[model samples]
Structure formats: C-alpha cells, structure tokens
Target: MTSQDERRAFWEERLAADWTETGVGYRALGRSFNEWMYRVRREVFLDRVGALDVDWTRARVLDVGSGTGFYVRAWQQLGAASITGSDLTEAAVARLRDHFPALRFERLDVAEPGDTFAGADFDAVSCMDVLFHITDDDRYTAAVESVARLVRPGGYFVFSENFLHRPAQRGVNQVNRPIGWITARLDRAGFDVVHRSPFLVLMNAQVDAGTLWRKAWGGVLRAATLTEPTGWLAGAALYPLERRLVRSRTESPTTEIMICRRR
Candidate 1:
C-alpha cells in the first residue's frame, strides 16, 4: 500500500506537469484527451439522470481541479455566460486559457490559503476526478465546505469519487471513499441532493478495475472497422455484459455522478 505522503506527492508531481494531453480512445479521438473523456463522462452521467437539457446558458461555473478545462469547455460550448477553471497546476491553467482563449482560467488551490478564486463567485461548481487526491481527511471536508461557500443558494455543485462495497475493498478503488460518507456533509452544508447516479461504481475487488476496464475496452475498440449496423449490434450485446459486470460491487467502480444544489 502507498503511504499518504507518497500518494499526495504522486498527484502533486502529476499535476506539476501537463497531463491533459494523454491520448485516449474515446468518442472524440481527434480532440484532446481531457475533452474526449469529458464528453464520455458527462454523457454517460447525464444519461443515468435522464437529463439532456443542462440549462447552462448564461450560467457562471467554477471548475475545481479543472485539468484541461474539459467540462468547462463543454458548458461554454452549450452557451454558458462564463466559466472559470481553477487548478493547482499553473501549466494546466495556462494551457486551458491558451487553448480556449475566450474562456477565463486561473491557478488556485482551494486547499491553500491566499489562493485566488476562493469563494462565493459562481452559480455552479464542479469538482471531478480529484476528490481522491486529497489524502488529508479534513482537507476533504474543507474542500467541500469551500465549494459550498463558493456557490449561491440553489446553485449546483457536482463532485465524484469511487466507493467500495466495504472498507475492505479499499485497495480496489485506489482512491478513497470519503465521498460516500460525505452525504451528511453535503446536507450539513445546506445542499440538497437533487440526484445521485450510481454508475461506473460496480467494479470493486479488482485493482482499479473500473478505470482499467474502461480504458482497455476503449483501446480494444479503437481499431474497429465495423459498419453502423454491426457496431450497433455489438453495442447492444456489449452493454448488457457491462451491466452484468458492474451490477455487483465485487466488480467495478467505473464512475458515478452525484448532483446536489446549495440550499
């Protein structure tokens, strides 16, 4: 098992460099890795909630740990009035602004004091794929509290992390599960749970099974040469298999979306 300091430095170093460029075999292959994964995660997430209308027009969104500004760009494309992306990595914020010149991006670590973009400046907030990086238990609490402070009442805040069936399955998810226990924290911070999508959360017991399985699946299909009908048939068959695999906590932790509104 990795020590807390080691794990913390893993992310600290990973973020110190630009990583949004990692190649992915997602739907938008020609686009950047972060962009493609953003679409995949967002679409799959919203599909669970049966929502197609995101209502992002004229909305101000603050994206925490906004590596590559994936979702920020997604919302901006949907006509959001403004999007502010904050990250610990200066390179990340720089690249995001450089690529999407129209949007606003800044460098800030909510965990650190005196960091800009600290509070009450957004109508929406999204913290994705970074909750596990917070090794300090209290830091997680602080992060959520700061997010709540930054959003207006009735505004939306979305954050996600994986969970195991039991604490014993901890190694399977690699990242931690304060996210699961924080349901009370969300309510305590005056947020109402509008929706929770428990998908990509089935693969436990296997080492990072959710993330690995997803990437392997993508890589396998990346070289596909099938026709539309063939691909559709394959998808129909594949989806059920995936469902069977993920239906049990013994299997996966691909992803999950929890949506809450500041009350």
Candidate 2:
C-alpha cells in the first residue's frame, strides 16, 4: 500500500477503537484530559474565529480533519450558513454522518493528487491540529496548497501548529515543523498569515521545548493522567491558569493557532 493508504488505515484502526476526543487528541492522557484539552481548543478557536471580520452566520465553512466533529459543532454554534466536514479516515466520516446527519461529512484526503473535495470556495477553512500528521514533506505541501485552493480570496484559513523556531522534530505520525518552513510554504500557497496566537500553554504536546522542559511536562502529565478522576481534577485546577496564559502569551512553547487569508 502507498504511504497515504497506510496513514488512512492507521487512522481508521485508531478511530474504530476509540472514537472520542481522546481518540483524536492525546489518547495516552486518557479521556478526561483529552476532553479538557479540547475545551481549551474550543475556547481559543471560538474566540479567534468570532473576532474575524467575516459574518460567520452567512459564511460557508469547511472543517478539514473533523475528528469527532468537534470543529463541525463549533461552526454550527457560530450559525454558519453551510458546513462540510471532511476526514481522511472512513471511520471518522461514518461516525460523523451518524452523529450529525444534518451536516455533510465526506472522506477527503487533501494531499491526494487532483481535487480531493468538490464544493464551492468556502469563506473559512479550518484544519486545526491536523497538518503535522502529514509526515511527508511533499504531501504536506500538497495539503496546504489544496487548502488554499478551497478558500475564497480574502477568506480565512485557521490552523494549529507548534511553529518551532529550530529544526523540525518528527515522530511516527507527526512532525513539528519550523516556523520559517511553514511560513514559506503558506506564502507559496498564496496565504498571508495575519494572526498568530497561543492555543495551548501547558495542556498539550511541547514538541519544540528543551529536553528538561519536555521531561518535566511529561512528568506532570503522567501525574494528571494517573486516573480519570485525577485527570479531571488536574484539568480543572490548571484550566483557568492555562486560559490566562494562553490569552496573555504572545507565543507558546506548545501548539498555537495561526489565522491566514488567501491572497
């Protein structure tokens, strides 16, 4: 099988096993922590998108990687005129269709050759916490370009990344790319990044940090994830603090959201 097929199967198996926020998010951290992490994502996402100049209630929106239909619901809450949710894995699409029969959910692989999705240009395209999963550099470029193509000129493309200043760090399924590499890719794809803000300060992966910080953060996560109750408590205790930090910080050691306009 091709690498794309392999990646699809990998996600299919994973979502089939645990189709929850935890399944799409930090699974090792368990359900409660993952839920909290997504709560943070929701807050940051809505705050950012709500502030955009577009009138969401009249805008057509597309959410790529609609894992567990989290962002799909966000769009719905914002009263989008039309919403389409797409995922690379069949498992997610099936589940999303079942859970949200009123919405459209399709199996879409953005990196695939030619057009992967069929629709009019969207006013906003959200591919949050999804790009890094395209491990191959060529595939990543295709995905970004495809996303750019899907958005109308002057429309928004909001995504999340580590935006590392140093060299990229690759894992089995993800890559934390440097800010320069990502910006150049976006520029070539006809996107002008207008806003960069913190999404998570201490609630998720710290792929760009030093060894000591990563280890220390790992220890804290281990403690928080000891049990479901502990996870809930930890999440509750740290959530407010995390929100403050995310709001106040200009940049983060972990993941951050970037809002771009098709130029």
Off by over 4 Å in 1: 1-18, 21-39, 45-54, 113-115, 168-174, 178-180, 199-252
Question: Can you write out model 1's per-residue Cα lDDT over 1-263, one digit (the tens) per residue?
Answer: 55544754554566455355232112222233223234346554445323533566767888887776666755665666777787766657677788778767776656552646645567788887666556555666777787888888778887766644434234421455644566766777788887655444322122234567757655544433134444444444445455544334332444556778888
The 0-to-1 C-alpha lDDT of every candidate, in the order given, reads: 0.58, 0.89
Model 2, span 1-263: residue lDDT tens: 13777888889999999999988998888899888888889999999988888888899899999989999988888889999999988899999999999988888988762555655689999998899988999889999998988999999999998899889988778888999999999999999989999999898867778889988998889887889999988888889999899899998989999999999
TM values, all candidates: 0.68, 0.97
TM-score of 1: 0.68
Best by TM-score: 2
lDDT of candidate 1 vs native? Answer: 0.58
